[model samples]
Target: MVGRGRPPPPPQVARDEGIRPRRRNMEDEENMYGKLKFNMPKFKGEDDAEAYLSWALKVDKIFRIHNYSGAKKVAMASLEFEDYANTWWEQVVTLREEKGDPPIDTWEDMKEEMQARFVPTHYKTDLFNKLQKLKQGTKTVEEFFKEMELTMMRANIQESENQTIARFFNGLNYPIKKIVEFQQYSNMVELVHQASKAERQVNEDIKYSKSKQMIRGGLWTPPPQDRQALLVVQ
Candidate 1:
């Protein structure tokens, strides 16, 4: 009965302790999700299958704790990760709400949380991956050009200017991501117009590959400029 005078000891302490373990459990649950990668298919359902598929997933990290008594609060936080052609550079976006203020936390917590995030991806396009490898200094320019040319020859569509540009873009030292972007353009005009700084070089590189293919295949043709050349691109 003598301890009864202690004023029932603050109940917030007990509540906070109880919440911590549950929050940790939630963190563990999030880790269970792991990570995944998604690759955009080249040419809608061609060369093989006739099925369309999209990759998606979602998770909630509700166990985040909040503290108002000095340095033991968990603010609202959310993080998202996405993948590209290569799993090596998966995308992760994070948003946090903390103590009704901007995110504030210790280095340890930030480091641990960063290390905890999981991101996995794969090489969706072999040629694209090769291009990235060249950009990363992992592959040589010659190697990239070789595979790119082969891919172009194999995936040759329309056998027109667009396909030629795609081939040159694929062979460049630029990363696969940008090359894919160029290839996705609506038409040769858009492609040429929308091309990035790297893409300008692509236009010139295509000339080399175009002539090589012509010689190898014994295919020859003149420029599409005839009597309608009173106005030039210049």
Candidate 2:
């Protein structure tokens, strides 16, 4: 019976094996944290609402890309705070403790807290006003579309697909809008696509007209104040 079984590993070998997995896990965590910190955007508690919104958007993107848990997302984002932002976070933690409220552990909760502190109450109203007045102006169709989309997002607008399409269509330049208005579109994507095509066609038409003008100009031989000189050369 004694000869049938193998002896256990030495104490040192057992300890080394036990430490290896833990060491690997620690290294992995460190590497992940390093990457998160590297990619995270720093916030300095600016008075500008748009700046805060922009930082929030960038941080949200980074968290989504990493698939971070709520708690981890909050933790990683807090690390990127700077100057007044860092002080604000510290005050938030203290205030929660004083009120006996649990620390903010979710990304959504953290965002709300930050927005309340950083974004002015008038920010959304201003953004909405700007959106209402937004027009294609001199911007390209794509640029105008992007501005509209960003404004809508910042304003936290919620609307049906048809409504959004209508808004976008209405903002288009008159030429493009007139052409696109006749087309049927079921969604914003289709509307944008049609508008873009119309824009290209409009641009081509303008180019063609300009080219024709240039050709006409080049072909004209000034009705010669020198008709006599012209006749002599002939």
Candidate 3:
């Protein structure tokens, strides 16, 4: 063949010797997370499970559980107070508020203090009896909560406890999807004191449904005079 001297051996063989791995292509690899976009949040309707979940989250965040949901209320209230109660007393132990220095740091310090400190007392007793009605199965979690003392909101439990309860309920597989009202997942938190012991300053008998802010620290004073409106802890 008079073409080219060695005629390029074979296209494949020639290419192999000349080609290198096209250099690792770092550019493509560096880009991973994709684009960010702005979007509005969404809210589910009354029957939607998301709605209940949203309510549950709201409930879990509150400090007190005077809600209509009986033992459930007590449980939630208790859970709310637990961590705060631990830290609050630790601050008190130093006795002197001089430097505002933290006195306790370790888990052991907390544990010892917990044993030494008395749990705060409560005033509400009937909330327990009201909760017991659940055993009769005559009413749903929603209904019992709705019927109980002063208006109430849903309450949540600790994460580990919450998951455990969720697993238990899910195991039951009790036609929960069909029932409009039920506790799909939740844990119980008990109260540190009698419900009555927790006081709000309002002289007016504003039900939980009526009250916008659940003020736990003594009587409420209105307007510019009320520091709560302006105060941001951070």
Report every candidate's CA lDDT: 0.40, 0.87, 0.35
The TM-score values for the models, in the order shown, are: 0.18, 0.72, 0.18
Best-matching candidate per TM-score: 2
Cα displacement (Å) at residue 175, model 2 = 1.3
Model 2 lDDT, residue 104, Cα:
98
Greater lDDT among 1 and 2 belongs to 2
TM-score of 1: 0.18
Q: Candidate 3, 215: how far from true, in Å?
A: 52
Candidate 1, residue 175: how far the Cα is off, in Å: 15
For model 3, the superposed segments whose C-alpha errors exceed 4 Å read 1-93, 96-102, 106-119, 122-127, 133-141, 145-234
> Which residue pairs collide, candidate 2?
none
**For candidate 3, lDDT tens digit of each residue in 1-234?**
556665545545655554444433443333321232212222222333334345444544441322234444433323344344535543565563566766554433433444344322221233334333322134443333334312121222224655433332332213332231232222322110111112121113345524545366535555564566557532
Which residues of candidate 2, in runs, are more than 4 Å off? 1-38, 65-69, 218-234
lDDT of 2 by residue, 15-74 (tens): 588899999998898678657654678899999888999998888776665656889989
Candidate 3 at 162: error in angstroms?
Answer: 17
